[model samples]
Structures are given as structure tokens and as C-alpha cells.
Target: MPYPSSDTPAANPSPADSRAARLWEALPGLSYGADYNPEQWPEDIRRQDVELMKEAGVTVLSVGIFSWAWLEPSEGRYDFAWLDGVLDSLADAGIKVALATATAAPPAWLVLKHPEILPVAADGTTLGPGSRRHYSPSSSVYRRYAARMTRALADRYGDHPALALWHVDNELGCHISEYYGPEDAEAFRGWLRRRYGSIEALNDAWGTAFWSQRYGGFAEVQPPAPAPTTLNPTQQLDFQRFSSWALIDFYNMLAAVIHEVTPDVPTTTNLMASSATKSMDYFSWAKDLDVIANDHYLVAADTERHIELAFSADLTRGIADGKPWMLMEHSTSAVNWQPRNLPKLPGEMARNSLAHVARGSDAVMFFQWRQSRQGSEKFHSAMVPHDGTATRVWREVVELGAALKALAQVQGSRVESRTAIIFDYEAWWASELDSHPSQDVKYLTLLRAFHRELFLRGITADLVQPGADLSGYSLILVCTLYTVTDAAAANIAAAAERGATVLVSYFSGIVDQHDAVRLGGYPGAFRELLGINSEEFHPLPQHGTVGLDNGWKGRIWSENVRLAGAEAVVSFTGHPLAGVPALTRRVVGSGAAWYLATFPDDTSLAGLLDSLLAESGVAAPATAPAGVELTRRLGAGGASFLFVINHTGAEADVAASGRELVTGTQFSGVVQPGAVAVIVEDAPGGQPG
Candidate 1:
């Protein structure tokens, strides 16, 4: 099979694609609004919502997200009177609608009738339908009902003047990503037959010969459910793949109906694309979505949560192939899901929303419009808090709306970066499997740390897929990619050979796509390109650290690395494997390949990245204080927008001159503390300095 590349033309559509073009034509400006659940409110309150939405400068709203029961009170019965009124009211108020198919949750009647549609956990616990996303991804009965609901929606609203896009379903793979029910087992076998083609091929790929797990036929295989002991790692990996594909397959089934009914209208589904969401390989799903949209919420526990938001936004932009994407949901204040949902401080909401815009998002929206009076998400913050429009959240929502309106020209712009970070969802799933050399080797640990360092340095990096075209990137960072296809490995090596600086971290390139070890040595795929090989891993205990010859501390991992044809940049100072190279650099043509055999502390990692940046000539967009974040988005005719976010307590000075979109004033490069600015550069050439 060919390695998946994000650069594949068919997978990533251009900004001028008809779907994106139609979306822009419908919304006309930077979109602002939330998930509007008028079904939960009375007609009087629904009328009040339009008035408030107009005042807030909301241009769009996602309607009928959880309205399955409301749409159809009983099986084979339908009602669209309430939804008709809602859409008409929004249209009268000049707000567009991303009308949902209303199949996120099955109604009580449908689920009660076909209980097998519910998802079963790995331990055989069936999840009921009280919560959203309760249906199994592979349930044929569920898909049939969902398709019918979708057709009903598209048929009714296909020609509605207010319809902008067809929201296929709510956040997919959110609560119930995997299922182990009878339906899922049958679906998994069918998917395996399609993927492997033959039982012999399946056995070969799974390496089932080990532990007597080989199968006589595809029927003998099953989901990696509860077992007597440790289950097969390959089986677990394949199940993850199958679960993700099943959801996409389900999405396609609904999308096809929408296309058939309303071929002109674009269709999309909100994806949980942040670091917290790992169940779906969104890169694979991006091809199916007419426009990429994602939901992100700040982790209340993380002090630097905004950095994580930037990372997520950047990754989403990468999934969109550098095109503008939509931020379907975020929060105006505190979210109900976290253990301790902390309310946003004054101006924090604007900063959060604009941070996403600064990265690549063309629209900024939230999870809900009005605060729920009663439900599981009653406490979840919204555009209108329980205190009505008199609260801080409401004021911020209005202010954010006005700000987005002022920055309307920033839409359709693209964030450009010469540095690329290789991010693979399958690799993330495979590397974090059980029984690894170290449990501390988390998939996102290194990527997040490195992205934070880059953010602090004001250097924007694109999260590219493994098999993507790498020749354009001046610097490529491959961190802990334990599983990779041979084609992807060759692509990275080719990038380095073509004078692109490449960095490969520890435990990478150890296994093939099938989770089988490469025959030669550790980091087997890139050993020749990296000019190094390791015989074994030396993972440290919890909270343990190792010293390096360069005075850096290595934690969580160390390796018995031996330089094959490269020079050691840093070596282990002492231990059972004393004087071993901790870091090595190999000169390949005009470029260099650097290898880190262990994880370094933050300060050391920053220093090493600084060195790499200097060597590769990748500099920050502008000079600013440590806490200020800078990113640039380029548009047509050599136009650029500079986004400066100051997270520090003290005001900072940056070397930039432009008309600030946030304040509508000429910026002299001075930014106030805890504020955000999007500056439109005055110069004709918008290249970053």
C-alpha cells in the first residue's frame, strides 16, 4: 500500500475549491456565533436570541445539533415546524446557518427498538443513549436512521436562503470512539477483508505466528477486547485504525446523501482535533470534509493552555493543507467538563479567540449560544450566561464579535512556515501502545514541548503528515515516530539529501507499518541517513535523570547509541553505558541530520533548537519579549497580517509597523501586557523579516 501524503491533490482541496468558495459567499465575512439550541428554550426566549445575536454581530449559528428527538418524536414520524421557525428567524436577523443533520444522538424510540446499536465497551459494558454520541460507528441500523435524518434535513433546507453548510453530525468520535459489539465485530472483519484481501496476508501483517495467535481465516479474528493476558499489539493497532475508518465511513454515508440532495451546498462535521482528541486520524478524514472545522477548549489545569491552542490550530491548518479552516467550537469562559472549570479572566476570551485566528482559523465560534438551564452541560459557559447579557461572558462575546468584524479582511489568508513537524496519528497510536520500552514515551510529549519552544521563539511550524512533500521545508523534526512506512522513511531521507535540515529523535523508525521491527537495528529505517545505530534502549525510572557530556540532563529515555558515520555532538557523561553519544549530527550533502538519543530538559532543548534554527536560517517573524507570541499570515498581493499575543504581565516592544486590526490604529510595535493585536503590514512585500 502507498503511504498517505497530505499533499495528495485529491486529499487536500485548494482555497478556491467550490465548497470553500460557496461557504465564503454565504457567510461573507469572518464568522462568529455558537451552537444555537432553540429547542431547549420557549418561543419567547427564541425571539430574544435573535435580538441578542444581532447585537453580538454573530454571522452564523450551528442549529439542530442535538434535535433528533425534537425532529422526530417517534419512529417514522417527522416534524420540522420548530426548526423552520428557527431558520426563518435567523435569516430575518441576517445570520446564516450551518444546519445539522440532527443524528448525533439517537432518540429513545430508535435506541429502545434496536438496543444493539449502542456501543459496547471492551469489557462488554453497553453505553446507553442518555448522552450524545452513544451509537456504534459500525451499526448498520444506526447508519440507516442517520442517513434518513440527513436526507430529511437536506431535502427541506436544500433551497433555504439561510442555509450555508450542511453540518453532518456533532463532534464525531468524541464520547464513543470504539465499540466491541456484535455489529462492530462483523464490521471489523469485513474491513480487515477489504484492507488485507486474504487471510494469509492478514496473518503475515499481524505477525500472528507469535504466541499461537495465527488465524485460519478472517472469521477467527476479533477486536482486541478483554483477554486473559496482554493482547496482540498489532491487533490493537489495527482496531484503532478500523475504529477511525468506521467513523469516516459513517460520515461518508451521510455526506453522500447531502451531496445527492443538495449538491451545491458544502458539508462538514466538527472534529475534536486538539491534543486531547486522539481517536481519529483527522488527516485521513480531511479528504471527506468539504471544509475542515474543529472544536477546541482550553485545559483549565494547564497554565500555558494558549500554547496548546496554537499547536492545535496549527495542526488543523496542516490538515487543511495550509488553507483557512474553521474553529467550530471553543468557550467564552469556563467549560463544564473539566474537574475545576475556571472562569476566564477579563480579555482572556478575546485572546483565546484571536490566538486561533492568528494561527490559521478563518472563523471563531463556540460550543453553545445560550447557557443551558438544565442538562449535562448546564454549567458549560456560552455566549449568553445564565445571568443573561449583563454578565462578563456576554460582554466578551459582543466585544469578540465586533473584533472579528473589524478583521474581516484577514479571512482566506494562509499561515506560511518553512519549518515542518512530522505528525502522524497512526504513529501516535502505535508508539503509545502497551509494553513499550518506556511508558513515559508519550506521542505528544516531545511534539508539544518542541512546539512550545518554537512558540516562545516566535517561529511558526507546520505539522505535516509523514509522507508529505518535504523538499519545501528547510527544517523537519521527526519526534518519536516509532512506526512508519518505508515510503515515508524514504521521503524524509530524501528531504535531508536535498539540503533540508532534519532531526530524528529517539525510538523513531524502529518498526514497520505492521508494527514489526526492522531487521537491521534500532532506528532501522533512518540508520543510514542519520548515520547512527542503537542496539538497545536505556529508559530511566520515574523522576530519574541522566547527565550528558554537554551539561544537559536527559530524562525518561537514553540509548546505547554508537555512531556509524556521524560525529557525536553530546555524549552520556556517566552510567552503565559511559561515554556513549547522547546526540549526533551527520552531514548529508549540504544539509545535516541530527539525532537525539535521549530527552533533554527544557532549557537544553531550547538551546539545541536555537542552534538548529540558526544553522537552518529559520528566524522568528519579529523580535519581541519572551512571553509575546508572533505569527504571520500572508494573503494575495504581498499582504500580511501580524498577530502579536502578549501573555506577560509587562508590556513588550516588537519591531513591526502596521495598522493594527484590533484597535484600528497605526501600530508602532509596542504591545500592552495581556493584550492581543493583529497588524496589517504597510509594506508591499509581506515577507517575514
Candidate 2:
């Protein structure tokens, strides 16, 4: 089968889909590669690397990521001889290149000459150089230097035969993400001035009058710096937003340089572990990129690793608007940074890579091509381990590469879902701020609870922002949305009017984007749509539980809700808020809105979601056992590819029969532990037996 071309036009979708379709139309086949730093190895070793690249079926390599010092040994001095050789060698081996600007890390000489470029912490301590990503995003000196270097590199290699993509400044906002230096303070103040005309308006928006934190002028307004006591939460939240934008501006600078030099070359910066960090708002950053790329590492501490991986991948795909994205970096096995550093069980790595591909990743890549004997990530697994091709990691690397070849037909496909969960960065930052009614009122906790239940049912939901177009979805979940805007509320209302069932959880719509309480009772903007009014919040003690009349227990939070036009689906039992609605549903125009005033346990949440799914006429594609994840990708040519991944330690079965593309066998029954089954659709799934 021929791979989809970069010029294939897609059918009509929403406006967002059209923008995403343009991106998808520029990407052709699945890119299988790794980040190769041939600068680390000797001449002979570099030559041998090409053979290993071919052996592992590597098609692309991201070179010169951290080679800033090597590329420019001294001020105004150039040394592209090594990189020129590496690029030429890779081209000779039929491997493409995602060339880096090599400006992510400045050399020691530059850092020493311009020490003001180093980042500072909230406590006003300047971070010394030695580590990567230490430059302040707002530093003028750093920006000038980085931009000049980026321009030179782009101009030199813009038309290189091996150049396939341009990777702008590696992993923006990873380490030293938020800077609080003098330069950053000035930049933050400028950002605030542009946002609010004067200090008085800023004071009012920050609600600084209550704590006597009112700013006398723009100079008085500083980022939420460390103090003896608790800093103002709203100020800190705004600073976080400013810091993210500053870093984004840093990325945009390099991107501008690259675009001016090489307009046709697509550019992207790897967004790292968004599920774990809320430093950067990816939704805003996604708009700036020609292609969206992400680096996802498993949270070793989480017991349900697969679920978290799926959530992150699905979220990344959603950020791409179901367009093909690049899995820029992932470990082949054990990552060195985690405390435990547990090696993945056999076949686990393959399963994890395929999970990303199943979601929407057109490219599957790892961090490093060869293991490092030095540096901070020496122990991190690589495609070619220190033991070379004689190791298990190498074997699995070859196997996964071959599997990707066989699954090339899945390229340019998109995952379609009738369900979507609102994952907002502003809400996450606002809800996690100090001084919430309950300390446990988290954004991801509630989101994952609902998402895990849907995952178990073999249902895939698109993770979207609160204000995204929901007309394409049948069921939409807004969980722990403490901060909401009028436009977002209107979008939800419109979706409900269009016959979509919108389910909202506790602590939603309680505050605006400014972090001010939405007066006129709780759930300010959504009161009319949800058909419920909340009076007061009853935050339970830690590890507390409240029994409900529907044989379910509520945890973490419960609210005093009075029904307006909605009917109570679940009421509190034997509590102070007895007979008051814990969960209520109301019909709004053509659709329905259900509000849960308290957090429900797994069983209760699952039961509630099942009812919501049934009411919306949404069902799983097939009946699969627990620990088995099933998702489908639809190609532009009307081909459907189903991925079944069994993440358990034992065998599990799915009720669908197809030709298992991975093993080239007819699979009808069971899949072994840590196994993945890629099935090209021959018959409709979930058909009546």
C-alpha cells in the first residue's frame, strides 16, 4: 500500500479541523527515528552508527540539539566541519534529519561573558551555568545571541538534502522554566502594563485590596516572589502565565529566525510532560507551530502507567486537533531520572510506542541513538545500548521499527471520538492555587477519574479545552473547572442546545479567569445552563467519605445544591445536606446538562458515565476486559485501524476478530501480557454475535 501523500485534502470539518488538516496534509509517512548526537562518538563509532540506524530502521535523526559549544567554540568563531560531516554521513545512509538550531544551550564562554543571562529562582538566587536550559527567556543578550546563531544555521542548511524538519530550541520550559531575575521582573511588569492599562486596574483585577497588597504603580507590581509568608495566589498565577508566555516568546524568536531563513521547512519545539507540568499553556503554543511535537516519559511512581500514557498521548493528539504529531523523545527502557529507574518488562516498550501511534503520533522516536557513558542521562536506555545490538533493548528496537513499517498504512489517519473532556491550563493553574476550600481539589485527579472509567469501557474521548467546538461530540465532560470564561460557558450552552450531553463536576464555574469568586452564588456562569444553584461549599476532611442515597459514597467535596429546574439523580443520605441534590440533571433546549456536586468514587462515577453514555447513544467499539485499551484510527481513504493493548500482567481477551497486523495471524481470543494487537478493520466491531 502506498503511503498517504503530503497533499491529500481532507473532507469538511470544523474550522479548527481545517487548520489541522492543512498540517496533516504536509506530513507523509510515519517518521521512525531518534535524537542522534554523533558529536559524542569518535569518527569510526559515527560511521558504525549508520549501520545501526539502518538495522533499527531509523529514517530520521535529530542532530546538533546541544552542540552549541561545539558549533561555536569561541565568540564569532565557527566550527561546522563536524556537523557538515555528520549530515553528509547521514545523507549517504539514506537517513533524513530534523536539524536543530544548536542554540538551546549556550557555551560556557557566552554564559561567563553574559552572566546576566542566567535564570534566577523565586528566592532571588541566580542559577549558575553548568546545566542545560539555564538561560533566562527574557534576557536581551541571550535572545540576540540565540537568534543570530539560529539565523546562521538555518541559512547554511535550509536547502540541505537531509533536512526534513527544523527543531527549534529543545524542550522549552523544562528546567529553569520560570525565571524571577531583574530582567524577568521588568518583562513581567511590561506584560502586566500591556494587559491592564494602569496599576489601579491591575490592583482591582488581582483583588489586592483585601490583603493590603494593592500596587501603588507598575513598578510596585513584582512577580509573586518568595516571602516570609504566603504570597498572593492571584499574583502568583498571573506570574505563571507571564512566565509561560515569556518562554513562548523565546521560542517564537527562534522560529521567526528559522522561518525568515527557511520558510518551507516546518518547525516545532518539543513540549515536555504536559500531564506532569502546567508551566506552559500548550493550547496557546500549538497555534504557533507548523507541527506539534511532544516528549512523554512515564511517571514511574504511578501504578497505572498505561492509563497515564494514554491520557497524555490523547491530550497531545487533541492539541494537534487529531492531526499527525511527532513523538520527539521517549526512553527505550529505564529512564535515569526516576528514583527507582525500573527497566521496562519485555515488550513493554513496544506496547508503549504503539500506544502513542494508536492515538495520533505519525512519528515514533527516542531520546538518544546510542547510550552515553557520560553526562546526566548515561543510564537512560537507548536504541543501541552500550552493549550494542547484543542487548534486549536493541532487539525490541528492531522489532518495533519493523512493526512501524508494517503499520505504515496508519499514517495520516485521525482518531474520531464522540466524547471529549475539557483540559484547561488556566483552570488547572487557578484551581491548584493555595487557599482553595479543599486542599484536594485538583484538576487532573477528577479528569483522570472520569477518563479512566471511560478508558476501561473501551471508549476514547478527545481531551480538549473548555471552549473548543463541542458540536462534534455527543458527550462532553467538564471536570473541576473552577475558572471559566463567558465564551466557554456559551460554547457549552451551545453544545447542549445542539443535543450534546454535558456533564460537569464539582468546583466548576466558581471563578473567572481573574481568580475572583463568581458571586451570585456558586457556579456563576453555568447556573442557568446546569439548572442548579450552589449556596455553600462543604469541604470534607482529608480521607473523608459521605454516603449518598443512591448507594454511592462521595469523597473530598460536597456542596449545598438547590435544584431550580433540574431533577436530583443522587441525593445525600444521613448528612447535614440530606435531601439536597448531590447530582442533578436538567434539559436545556434539545440536550441535557448533568451536574455532580461532589466527587464520586470509581464505581459510582462509572455508573453515572454509563447512564450518560447510554442517554447519548454512545457505546464502546467492542467488549474488552479490564487492562485492555481499544482505540480506532480512521485513514483519509476510509480505512479503519484498531489498536488493542493489554497492559496487565496476565492475558486478556477482546470480542473482535481481525487479521492481527503485528503478528500476521488471525486473532480471535486472547492477547498476552504487555502485548499489542494492531488490527486492520475487515468487519465492523461490536456486531451482535
List CA RMSD, all candidates: 2.9, 3.2
Q: How far off is model 2, as Cα RMSD? A: 3.2
The candidate maximizing TM-score is 1
Model 1 C-alpha lDDT per residue in residues 1-689, reported as the tens digit of each score: 01122233345645336777789778766899899999999999999999999999999999999999999999879988999999998888889999999988899999889998898999999988778888997888999999988998888999998999888888888877898999999999999999999999999999988999989998899999878888899999999999999999998999999999888789899988888899999999988888999999999889999899989998998888787789999998999988999998888999999999988888999979999999999999999999998887888898889999999988877786889999999999999999888999999998888899999999999998999878778889999999999999999988888888999999899999899999877888999999998998999999989998778888999989888999999999876878999989999988999999888999789988988898888988889989898998877665688899999989899998888887888886789888988888777464332
TM-score of each: 0.97, 0.95
CA error at residue 317 for candidate 1, angstroms = 1.0
Q: Name the runs in model 1 displaced over 4 angstroms.
A: 1-16, 684-689
What is the C-alpha lDDT profile of model 2 across 320-378, one tens digit per residue? 76678889999899999988998887888998899999888999999889999899989
Clashes of each: 0, 0
lDDT of each: 0.89, 0.85
For candidate 1, the 10 contiguous residues with the lowest summed lDDT are: 1-10
Candidate 1's displacement at residue 466, Å, is: 0.8
Q: What is the lDDT of candidate 1?
A: 0.89
